[model samples]
Each structure stands twice: as C-alpha cells, then as structure tokens.
Target: MSDQGNPDPTTMATDPTPSTTGPSARRRSLFKANGVPRSPREARASRIALDARERKRKREQLIMGKRFRSHFEDYEESDSEAEHEATPTEIQEINRGLAGSDEQVAKALKLLSARLVSPSAALEKFILAGECVPHLMRLIHSPNPEIQLQATWCLTNIAAGSEALCHKVLDAVPYLIQSLNPLNPDLADQAGWCLGNIAAEGPAFREHLVANGVVTPLVDLLTTSPNSQLTQTACFALSNLARNPGAPMQQLFDAGICGRLVKHLSQHESQDVASEVFWVLTYLTAGELQYAHRLVEQDVIPHLVAQLDKFADQGSAAIPLIRTLGNLSAIDDATTSRLLDHPEIIQQLLYWVAKSPARTVKKESLWVLSNITAGTKAHVNKVLKQDGAAVLTEVMSHDSYDLRREVSLGKREKLTGKMIRWVL
Candidate 1:
C-alpha cells in the first residue's frame, strides 16, 4: 500500500523490496503499514526519522531571528555570556541537518542565521568547531533563494567575529561575489555586507576580495541599485576594501570607484550614505598622491567644502570631511593650493579650531592647519591672515593636552617671528 495519506513522512513505512528469504525480507516483513515497527531494523529507521523531525521542529522555533543590522553601524560586541548556548550534541545535530534533505537544510540555515544576528562569539566558535563552514559555503549555491540568503547571512555574521573566524569564511568569497547581482538586491545587500566584514579584517583578506574581482560589481551596485539600503551597504563594503594601508588603489581607480564615490558624496541625501562615501575618499586620498589628484579631478574639493557647513553640527560626519581635506593638504603644496583656492576652507578650519564643540573636530581642524603651514610660507601667512594665529593661541591654552599638542605643532610650522609671538 502506498503511504500517500500519511501526513508525517517520518511515520510512514516504505514497502520492503521483495527478497523471499534474506534479511531484507525479514526486515520488511517486520513493519506494518500502520507504522508499528515489529523488529529492530524498522524500529531504528522509525527512530531516526522521528529524531530528524524533532530537530526540524526545534530549528523552526528559531526562524523568527533577530532583525538585520549592519555590522558597520552600532555593532555591539557580545559579552562573555552567550544569549543561547549550543551544546556539542546540538551543534552536531545542526551540522547533520545541513547535510540532510532540502527541507532540513533550509531549517538548519534558518536556525544558524537567526542565532548569528546577535554578537555571540562562543556560538560562532561552536559552529566553527563543528566544521559547518563548508556546508554553509555549499548552501550558498542552493537554487532556493531563501536558503541562499540565509547562508549568506550566517557567513556575514561569522565574518564579523575575530579575524581567525573571518578567515574561515574566506572560501565563500567567490560565491558571495556571485550574489552581487543587481537583480537580487536583498541577496546582493547581504553579500555586500559580508564582504565588508571580511574586508574589514585586514589587508590580506581585502586583497583576497579585490583579487576575486569584488570591486566591479560593488561599484555597479553602488551606482545602479535603486534600493537605498543596498546602495549604502555597497558603499560600506567599498570603504572597507579601500581602508587597507596597502590597499590596491590602482585596481579601485581602474574600476572608476573614486569618481563614483565623489558623485555619491555630492549628491546622496542620506547622511549615513554620505558619511561612508567620505570614509572611502578619506582612505583613498590617504594613499598615494595620485588618488588625491583623482579626487580633485572629479571636482571633489568644492563638494567636500560644501559639506563642511552641512555636517558642521554632526561631529562624526564633520570629522571625516576635515580629515579628507587634511589628507589632500598633506599631499603637497599643489594639492594644498587646491584647498586654499577656496578661501572659506581656511576660514572653516579656523572656526572649527576655535569654536567647534567636539575635541576631535578641533584636533582634525588643527591637523589640517598644521599640514597647511607645513606647506610654503604663503600657506602659513594665509592661515595667520585668517586669524589662525589667535585661534592657535587660544587652543594652546586649552586643558586638552591633545589639542595643545596639535597647536604647538602648528605653531612650529614655518611661522614668522611675528606670528610666533602672536601665538605664544
């Protein structure tokens, strides 16, 4: 009799193959259509299926996992205690489910993705210890979009752990890159987020990302994605990729990322998006002088200057804008001259040095001034002409040692004897 009417496949007994006299026959005969196993073999099969069902139910309970939050923004590290500790047996079962049927794999991924949303170092360690990364990498190729998305999500969080744990997920980089298609923005967003976390690990991993050709698609997404969240996430990933001290700026420049970043900085309305774009520019400009010049060629300086007043009340946002200008100024007198070409840029820096409430803003502003003074004597005179000397004197007397140190450095840079007396 066919078992079509049985609601639970686990309890349905399959017809035994016809073997008139062997052990197969004996085992087959031991089970009834009613699913009452009359022998050890049938009983074991029943128990295994029941166990699988139970595990599936347990996994389903965790489907309502935590909502998605970008690791780049407000990511809090988990304490020593994990919110839900997984036992060795539980991890083993999850791993088994990963290798099980399609339904089981989906449920297992759901559970894994759910738990990883919060910062649970121990849980990540436990999962890694179970050797489940290969399974996750495999699932990234699953035709099922939900499973593919969940697998990517799990890896994203895993990459958010320590550098060692992130290394374990590196093999998924290629598969993650494949998911960057603009047609699937949600999956692309998750993949971009994962790549960002991996790139954030260090230089080698970033090289891995770039070597795998992660830049082209990321730039594509940044430029073409209609979904603002995906666009922002792509920007975040590119920023991390460019963050390396040994970053492959040539590859990024070849990919035309610098121009795109400037476009977003000038046109994107979201402060968060603009802030991340600034970071990308900041890191890129911090590299070889060519990158700073490329940004200038993109007409980035005037856009950056315009943002100073817009982000003035926002210290976090304002800091990067100041730092980017400072990086340009430090490049050389020619680049510094580009910034000085805008007279308000100097006035703005002096205003922040004297009046901005954030110590970091004042510090970065003074740092830019120091770079300016480090340039030709004309740059120093321009700063002094803007009342920069008085600002330095006031800052030098402040209680903040860091600010005073910055002022002292600025005072020492090419200041005339008259300017020195004014600051002193």
Candidate 2:
C-alpha cells in the first residue's frame, strides 16, 4: 500500500527481472494502462498531450497578466465605485466618534497615541491629517477615567516629539494637572508621564509648567504619597524635568522638594525610586552648587553614599550613584567636607576605583577622589597613607593630570614621602 492511501489507481504491479531492474532497462507497473511503452505510437501520443498542457498553462498565465493589468490601470480612476468608500476628514471622524460613547473616544485616543511613536513626518501627518492635538486636548477632560488616561498618554507622547510638535499639547497642561489627582492612580501615572515630557522640552515649555504652578503639586505627589506605583511615576517625571540643563533648580528647591526627596530617598527600598532621586540630585547639584549645602543639611549625603555599595554591581543604579557622588564632591568646600565627614566615604570611593565592576564607576570614583584632594590639607594627607595611596596612584597612571598643580596640594602635600596627585 502507498503511504498516503491504499494505493494509487494509476500505479501497476510488475514482476522483478534482471533486465527490468538493471540500469539498461526500467520496470513498469503492469496494472496501469500506460505503464509500459507498448509501441512507438503510444509514446508519441503522450508527448503530444504534454505539449497541449504546456500551451494551456501559458495561455492561462497570459490571461492572469491581463487581469492584473486591468485592475492596476483602473485603480486610480475608480472614483465612481469608490464614492461609497469615502468618509469624513480625520477631525470630523474624531468629533463624530467622541459624540457617540465613552468607549469610542477612548479608542480614538488609543489610535492617536499608537501613531505618536512613528517617525516625525508620520507623526506630523497624523496630527495634520486628523487635527489630533486639539481633539486630544478636549478629550482629556472627559469624566471617563479611561478616556482621561488615554488622552494623557497620547498627550505625553505627542509632547515628546520635536519642539514645534510638542507645542500642540502645551495648552493641555491644566487638564494634565487635573488628571494627577488620586481618584485614579493609573490616570495620574499617565498624567505624570505627560507632564514629564513637557518639562523635558526647552526652557519655554518648562517655563509654561512653572508659570502654571504645576511644579509644587507634582513634587508633593512624590513626597507625600504612600503608593509606590504613583510615587515611582512622579519621581520619574521630576527627574526628566530636572534633566535639562538650567532646569528651574531654585524653583524646585524652593518648593521643598529637596528635603522631601531626601526623606523619601531614605525610606524607599525600590531601586527605581532611588535612581530617580539620584538623577534629580545630580541635576540639582549640577545647576547650582549651593543646593549641595541644602542637601547635606537634610542628611542625604550618608544615604547617597550607602547606594554606592547597594548598587555597585546591580541594576541601573551604579552609573547614577557614581555621578551623584561626583557632583556632590565637586563642590570645593561645603559638600566636600560633608562627604569626608561621612563614615567610610573615602574608603568606599577607593574600593570602587580599585574593584568596581564597571569602568564608569571606577572613573567616577576617581572623580570624587580628585575633587577630594582639592579640599583641606587633612583630606589630602588621609589619601596619601594606607591602601588609599595604591588606588590613587592607579588613578594617576590611568588618567592624564597637570602634575605641577596636583603635587602642590596644600603647598606640596606628599604621598609616602613623595609628592603626587591627579589633577583630573
């Protein structure tokens, strides 16, 4: 029996023979009508049939080509047929959809949000084609939680586009603020992301948020909320706002964010929130060194120092932790003294440069150390002795330094009876 069925009806059985099995001849199925070449006339008839089949196949191919060509040619001019397919403009569609039901508006905003991730031209196309931003701005106020959530989500991503594109949702700031309330943490989280993007833009966009008085309440959410999910999102928003250089540092500091962030940093065990605190600290310290004193007074330095070990070989915290340390230590007097005063800070920085898994951590540790040497005479002398000397020399060999100035720390401070330091 054949594998596929009982047997092919067209197949025939034949007796085994040397001549039939040998290469000189081949066996044939005895039961098939055309199993063997009975005569030259039979073979000739089979060849003719095959020729006809080939001609039929070519004819069919030609017909198919003509059919396709006809369809292609008529496509553009099929207006009369397509008249039934035409619909309203994109804005009209959105307005029409919104007028129907809550789910309808939510779905429309979801479609708009989905397109926001496209390339700039595509995003602009959707916005211009649908007049999306204005409709999104209006839909954000709908009483439905999901509609508000999606509107904020779309508005956030839209603002993440180019500066001109982001301007479209600037008017929606107040709505985003309203969405940040506690009735729905999910919606508030979405609103946080939206406002964060707006804050990430240039000075004008940031100024708009500040001018609208959105900063204080946003910070308050992170500081006061016990809900980790909502607080996590809020911290991320503030971090992005702080990322841009010259972001309103004093303004944020004045809002009591500094002290609250310090306290929040101490209790939050989640690395995500901790990373945001580090980033915000990095930004705040970079913009205004004066804020360093404020942070130290809040007793945040020890907590920041503790992160060097907690994240030394884990997660995304190492880079930011090291960066935060470098920024804090970069302040010549107030912050540097505070860092040295903190327990094991110098020892931790040394070990990090010597054994930390990442080169970035090691380099940032060196950064902190070099800045440390610029402090009081006692600070320079402390690194000159013990294991600190070995790491300091390793740092020197790996990095370029102005040896003339480096060796002259506190009027020629010496390491192990020899004067040396790294100027980086």
Candidate 3:
C-alpha cells in the first residue's frame, strides 16, 4: 500500500475508460479499450520481439567476427583498400618527418602507434603499403631515448597483430634489443614488451627472436633490472619464445634461462614476478627433453617446491607452481626421485589436493602424486611417508566430482587401492 492508503500508484485506477487506452492509461486501467480484462497476447508478442532482437544481435556479432578474421588473413598487397593506402608522395613526407628533429620523429612514431592500436584494418594496411617498417627500426637509434621508446612502443603494437603485421615488425628486432640496456630502464622495459609481441607469433617469428639474439639480452634484463615490472615483462617475452612446440630450444637452454628462472621463482617477494617466471619455467619444461633436463639440472624442482612453501598460503601461485613441478617430475624416473627426495614438495602437493577449492589444482596435484608413485618403490614410500595415502582417501571422498574422478583416475594402476589399503 502507498502512503495514501491505496495499493500504490500501480493499483488499478477507479476510472475505466474505453477509448483512452494509451500505454500509461492501459498501465493504470484494469479493463482494455474494449472493456475486456487484460490478456497475455500483448505481453507474449513483446517477449517474442525481444527474442528476435537477441537473435539478430548474435547474428551481427558473428558477421563482425567474420570480417575481423577475413581482414587479418588477407595479406595480398593489391587487395588492400586503395583509399587507405597513402600515396608515394605522402609516404616520402612521413619518412622525412621520421628523420626530422628528434621531437618530430617521436611524435610521428607516437602518431603511428596510435593509429596501429586502432582496429581499423585499413590503417594497418596503409602503414604496411608505405614500407615504413625499416624506418621505424632506425628511429630506435635516435639520440633521444624518448624517441627510441616511442618507436619501440609503435613496433610492439604493430607486432601484436596477425602474421602480416608481425613479419613487418620482425625487421626491428636488432634495434629493439639494443634499446633494452639497463641504463635506460624505461626503454628497456618497452623494448622487452615489443620483443614479446614479436615472439608471440608462430615458430617462424620465434626463431627470428632467437636469430636476432634476443634470449640472453632478455635474460639479462630479468637479472640486471631492479624493476619488477621489467623482469615480469622479460619473463613474458621468454614464455612466448618457449611456447612454440617445434622451435629449436637448445639456444634457450644454453642461455641459462633455467637457473635464472628458478632463482626468480624463489624471490617470491613479488607474486607477479614469481608467477611470470614460473610460467616461463613451466613452458620450458613442457618442451623437448633438453629443455626439461636443463630446467631440472638447474635445480628448478627445489625452487618450485620453495615457491609453493613461500606462497602456498597466498593460494594464487600454488596451482601453477605445482603443475610445473608435476610436469618436470615426469621427465624420468630420476626426476621423479628428485621430486620424491623433496618430501616437503609432496606434502605441498597434498596440501593443495586436500585444501584448494579449485579442482584443477587438486587434479594436477594428484597427477603429480601418480607420477611420483610410478617411479621406484622407494618413491612411493616417500609420498606414503608424507601421509599421501590419507590425502588420497580424503580427495576421493571430496565433494567435488571432478576432483574425485581426477584422483581415482590418477591412481587407477596397481598401486592405488593397494597403496590406500596398505597405508590404512
């Protein structure tokens, strides 16, 4: 009831008019213009219209997606929109502006960056048509570090698009790495970001990163810089480098990325930095045998365990860290022993298995346990020594269905039920 002691303004008005059936009057009246009671037909039509509008919206989104993909894939120079393509004279003018006063060059690069960041395929094609990529690289060498930074930023954005754009940006790698010197931390950070974009493409560009000598310099940035942000960005750059499945990884291992990343993991002072380093190591271990051997040889497992020990309570880094350890643990029987030798690591995995609310963490934890058990009998005893039997039983009875299935599947072999019974 309203304050006036009625059924609020929403109550039917006493006046039931027949011909004054406008929207508001209809809302107020209990009878329609025909003096009949309200019916569901009108409301039904409205709902149907809303449903049709929703379907139309979905169709439009699908068409937009197709356009984006088509634009990204169309690389033929002749097929590019001619109107967006700058004239040769205009291209020469922009080129001259790039070599003008340091400030003008910086502004020009910034302008290019702003345009590149736009979703306009026409603008991206225009830049490509003008063949301005090589010029952008030279701007990285300008006496002014700020100009170098803007150029690097532009390169990074241009490199972030599809393969066409990445190929264009790859020309700037040698100069990009040069700007990553410690003396200019800001320039170094942005340069690292740019290299990361270039590396994010497929194997061809990742190899370009290696061919242009990017790994060691990136590792240098991770090690030499005081800025956690820079280190994290460097880690990002390396992770992309390590992601390609068939890319040659020997050079990356030879660069000491293993020990560096492990050390970075232990420095859990910054969870963000530790997380990035953990991902880099994780990808490295997931690669070829040489990559896993190098990371394990660097004693990554201990640091991986230590990372869990340090940040387990935080709950953010625990799952990925455990997964990385589990991946490394599968290297071989000896690597499993290395993981078993670290009983605390087993306990850490058990802790997550039993406590983490995420089934993914619990599943990975159980998988790692299964890997450890698959080793020599001594390894099984190492985990059993840590009360893993009880942890498994608890997880089996966990309320989460996925967790229970994961644990059950992980222990499906001979040792599972027998191990549980033996421990009990």
Top TM-score hit: 1
Off by over 4 Å in 3: 1-118, 130-135, 265-268, 398-402, 412-416, 420-424
Indicate the TM-score of model 2. 0.68
Give the lowest summed-lDDT range of ten residues in model 1.
Answer: 1-10
Residue-by-residue lDDT tens digits, candidate 2, 1-424:
0000000101111111101221111112111333444566754564456446434533442221100000011122111121011123433565566555787886555445544433245447556555577677677777776676667776765675666767887888887877777556777767776686676665677778878877787888876577776776676567656655547777788888888888777888977667656766766666666777688678888888766666766522455666677788777666777777764777777777677776546666666666777666667766665366666666566644543223234233322234353422
| RMSD in Å for all candidates | 17.2, 23.1, 17.0
TM-score of 3: 0.67
- Ranked candidates, highest lDDT first: 1, 3, 2
Count of clashing pairs, candidate 3: 0
User: How far off is residue 93 in model 3, in Å?
Assistant: 14
- lDDT for 379 in candidate 3 is 76
Which scores greater on TM-score, model 1 or model 3?
A: 1
Error of 2 at 183 (Å): 3.7
Q: What is the TM-score of each candidate against the true structure?
A: 0.75, 0.68, 0.67
For residues 1-424, could you state the per-residue lDDT of candidate 1 as single tens digits? 0000000101111111112221111111224544355666757765566457444533332121111332111222211111233445556667888899889987776556545544355567665675679888788888987788877877876786667778888888888999899898888988987887787777898888988989888888877887876876776677677764657788888888877877877778877667666767777888788777888888999888877777777754576677788888888788888889888999988888777888768888888888888677888888878888778888777647887777667556566677666655
lDDT of each: 0.68, 0.58, 0.62
